[model samples]
Target chain A: MTETSHAIRIEDRDDPRIAAYRDVRERDLIGRQGCFIAEGEVVLRVLLGGARFDLDSILIAANRLDGLQPLLASVPRHVPVYAAASPVMDAVVGFHIHRGILAVGRIGAPLMADDLLTSLPPRALVLALVGIANHDNMGGIFRNAAAFGVNAVFLDDTSCDPLYRKAVRVSVGGCLKIPFARIGSAEVLVDALAAHGVAAYALSPSGTTDLSDLVPAAQSALLLGAEGPGLPHEVLQRAHTVRISMADGFDSLNVATSSGIALHALRAKSFPLT
Target chain B: MTETSHAIRIEDRDDPRIAAYRDVRERDLIGRQGCFIAEGEVVLRVLLGGARFDLDSILIAANRLDGLQPLLASVPRHVPVYAAASPVMDAVVGFHIHRGILAVGRIGAPLMADDLLTSLPPRALVLALVGIANHDNMGGIFRNAAAFGVNAVFLDDTSCDPLYRKAVRVSVGGCLKIPFARIGSAEVLVDALAAHGVAAYALSPSGTTDLSDLVPAAQSALLLGAEGPGLPHEVLQRAHTVRISMADGFDSLNVATSSGIALHALRAKSFPLT
Candidate 1:
């Protein structure tokens, strides 16, 4: 049942209250007034269940409000919860949203990278992404970071924004839960990690150390670069470089997949028998 | 330089010789008379470099033919090589093919599950997927399977076709390289593994053993299920169930990311110090 305080019925596609959700599927509608769209029922649940960010509004198919009372009740009373017909939503979003749930929230601002590093626990696992332009890989890396108990993520200047709609969707709302800061170039990231007393392991095909052979330090950071042109030479030279061995003829694993394996490899070493 | 023998120019979007390439971007052009389209430069390179399947034809934007001489020269003389102007190629493919290289290849028949299992080496790593309907997950898993030196992969009947164009694209041609066969049900898959003296590890959140604690066997298989429902109860009962531990409140990892981590974890154990 739609809550009396929550239900703001939207009959037309162009309803101004739900305007942010319109044409969402045409391309990424990220960073519209420092806000990002959280799509699907699961991601919306993440938004409503947490207080990490201010929820601006939510829009859903009118028919789905029946069993979602508890979920909807969590939405702040001030947040306009818009309900529209599925067809109206489809028309507005420019794509059929099978999940029929959407929410908009401010991303706030990226925290100071140095402050984020300083705030970590003594024994922490951090993910540092360098030159990761693809939203899919960026999202997957964040999902891995959250899963493996990463203390923080520091993205280099060249990496794509994790708040991008596709990235947030791909991360399964991990981009919401995890604390991330975008910093300067790869060289600056390496220097910061060193300054923070964090042992850095830069992953690349040409790395000097095998992933299995490297033991995790009390404070560790796994550095992942974009797929083709991997970590900059200066960055790789500064960190304790490592590589995941593959089958004889195989060249490389997908960057996102590689990070998952690499993060787990380090995470297992640090948290064995936990 | 476009190889002299390979310079078969396609003038019109409706060319009969290139009919299968038409509207390829609209949806998957897989299983057209037992054929599949291998798109992009990297994947096409994978197909031409290997002979696992016969190439039916090759198509490219004429502009890209200059630097691809060696790649095109390797195409068998008997194979039809077609080239078109970028616009014409764009019109036929329905979506803009930014990579501008495509190939049609025969999938042949999927190998018999029993035969594929029988052919594995004595000490082998294999992957088994169940009810993985999503093409992206299917592709990512195959990429992991190939990277970890999994001797073979087996998919249950309920899973989607890996040769579907999107899956192939996602796998980065791991689907074309690694041998895979579709078996019956999850139960039947378990039975086959048992018969082959392969120790099966089924990943589930509710599994009895933590992933970090599991030791791989000489003949081991990692079984993965779809994201939400995970492995069926019957299948879990039949295998050594394992779970990748997460942070306190996190629920799950992406299926493909989970497989990469799981496969690598097991691979690290089976081939320790390799």
Candidate 2:
């Protein structure tokens, strides 16, 4: 049973309190005033469970509140919980939300790339990305990073915002859980990583050592680029080049897949197969 | 300059010759009559470069024809090439044709799972998939197979058709080049592989042996399931249960990424770590 005291029933789709949730696809692009939308039960749980992001409000379909009772109970009573009928919810969002759970949260203060790097504990694994503009790939990378224990993600400007709605959903709330900050250009990011005593490996189709042969340093970062252009030439020159040792003629693997494989390989560095 | 002899200009979007290329997104669902559309330049090149699929026709935008001259010259004279103005091309497809190159080809005769097994050379690697409904995942799997030298791919009946347009596009033409066949159910497919002296391994999070520790036989097949409800319980029981040994309290890696890592590990088995 939902705690009715904390809930506000919304009969009007145009209610002012729920304005942040209206026309979500468009608002995702223009209306993000330092606040981002967390969709689905899992992401909402992540937003409320952690102190990293402050919950602004939650707009949930009436039917879904019953199923989400346990999760809702966990939400701080001070936060507003707005409930809408399923049809009104669809009209407000301009599309049918199959998941039917949504929350708005302030992303908190800006985290500088340097601060993110400084925060990493020794013997950390980091995923450094350049030109990863595709939302799905970014989300997948974050999900992989969390699964394989990446300490944090450092992104160049060319990469998409991990806080983007689609990316948050695709990450399975990983973007919310994992710590990430957009640094400057690829060069600046790598230089900062080096300054912090983190060795970086640029993952490419052409590299000196097979990915399986990479021996991770006490602090390691795997530099990745978008699919087509791959890492810039200068960036590859700056870091140790690593290849996955694929068959001669085939094209390179997807960046997200390659990163996952590379992270797993590097993580295995500490284990040293007996 | 485009070769003018074989090219027919299409002023009308409704030109019957270009019928196969109309409203592709919808037609992909109900109208794939043993034939499929290949989108973009690279996939079109792969479609023409290989004989496994017969070219039914070629459609090109007037502007793009010049750059695709060499590719067009390679097409058999009997295969008619249709050219439309950019606007006509867009109207025909019901969406902007960004790459502006498309081809339709017959998928060729059906190959049975047993036939695919018998056709493999000695010391082969096969990727057997169950419930792989996502097109992008299917495409990524095929690309990985091509990269790591997977001899062929076997899919259970529940898996989506690899010839779906999105799957082909995502594969970056791997679907065109790599040989795949849908064999009955998961049990039947695994049984056939066992009969062929091929060792089968089901990848799961709870497997007994770490993926890094598995030894590959002369002929090996890695069985993978869809993301949510991994390979069925009975199937895991029958095969040697193998896992990637992920970090504690994290989800399993993406199915496509898992397959790539598993394939790489088995591929490395022949070169055991010293």
Candidate 3:
């Protein structure tokens, strides 16, 4: 159980050597200031293969270290590997650990809204979160964004941080693959969309215009909001409000689910190959 | 807090008076018998208004009892209400409190596979879960099923109980509204689907037939599996495998998200009325 190559072994929960791994819960409390953690081998591998994110280190359960040896072999030998017994790992994480492996990654700098606009193809679908505070929904949106051909994502200040551990885990590592930016305000986002010549459509269950009626624009940004409250009046006033027609008696679709359907409908009309 | 009309005060968690709310975690243990617990006022109201399910009782935190007074007024005096302090309520439920209300409902008697078939329309889109074990995905399927006009859902033996608390909560109480039945085995479900003149299509991320190309059958059953392992070989062998076309480099969508899109597309073509 002790045979290891490059991974560092630590039996202590308070090891200053693993300071980044300590106070894991506090990381999520700081909002945008904290790092994102990807758990399990599947998500870790996806994050590593994806473009331009800093991997802080990989932690492996002492007994299960061999299970991740092949993954370790692929990465640079200099990358630190923290190995600990299951009990020690549990104590450090402050929870019962199911996934035997964990990887901490630094959140990349936010992209300029204009950069996302120009970088995307002429015909592209983008997801814009106006004030979605639910971390799981934010994660689900990113996952759907990757599934459908969403070129980029823009999160207003009110949206939850997509790089939080729960978001990353819920996204199944899709947050790493999809290009996203955090714009300052809804007004700024609307203006940015205008500058890029991208039609910004707010998705509201009770919107006046039918989403199906709108001919897919060359490039479009779908503005989504939190459930119940929906998009702010100012935000809706600034952009076109479009509704996905649903059968009567149904209240509304979940925000993330609605985004998936909306993105698919948008992509169905004009998915950019380039 | 003591102004009670129908609400009965319960001072002890161990009191037989609250037997319906006892050992909820243990009751939720698979293969063990359990009653369904629905949280939040919104979901509780939805269930009461929409479904024919039996109500056992309602539990509310003492501080929030007044908020639920109107709802209690509508229910029969025979239906007991239990009130406790927030801390006591949390201690009994083994979790922190939110929504400040919980309703226990008796599980409806199991529906026969034939019953679902008889109820289905001529042009129907149904979701058949062959081996989906995740309760969240099961719940998501029901939510999407309701939204997209999936006529009914047939759960195979390998699938988790759709009425599990987590599933019900995640489904946003759609489990109560959506018509579903446990079909015992894949063979029985296949037979029932065939009897209803439904075409059984297994959804795979890498199947031969493109999903867009597959015309909606007079009646269609979209079969989905667990996220990673995918549809069981036997089920796929029995079904017509269809693949959802996606942009290259992205992995498969979460099973629930995939189901949502598949159901939406199929419903549009199959159930034109919806």
Q: Compare the candidates by DockQ and give the number of the best one.
A: 1
DockQ, per model, reads 0.62, 0.51, 0.50
Can you tell me which runs of candidate 2 are displaced by over 4 Å? A1-6, A271-274, B1-3, B271-274
Q: Candidate 1, which CAPRI tier?
A: medium
lDDT of 1 at A117: 89
Chain B TM-score, all predictions listed: 0.95, 0.94, 0.89
Write down the lDDT of every candidate, Cα atoms only: 0.84, 0.85, 0.79
Per-residue lDDT, model 2, residue B253, is 81
Which has the greatest TM-score?
2
User: Per-prediction TM-score, please?
Assistant: 0.94, 0.95, 0.90
* Candidates ranked, most accurate by TM-score first: 2, 1, 3
Question: Candidate 3, residues A74-108: lDDT per residue as tens digits?
Answer: 76665698999999988887776698788877776
In model 2, state the lDDT of residue B61. Answer: 90
Please write out the lDDT profile of model 2 over residues A57-122, one tens digit for every residue: 998889888788778888887889999998999999999989888899888887788888888876
- Which runs of model 1 end up more than 4 angstroms from their true locations? A1-5, A26-31, A271-274, B1-3, B26-30, B272-274
Docking class of 3: medium
**Two-chain complex of model 1, DockQ on C-alpha atoms against the true structure:** 0.62
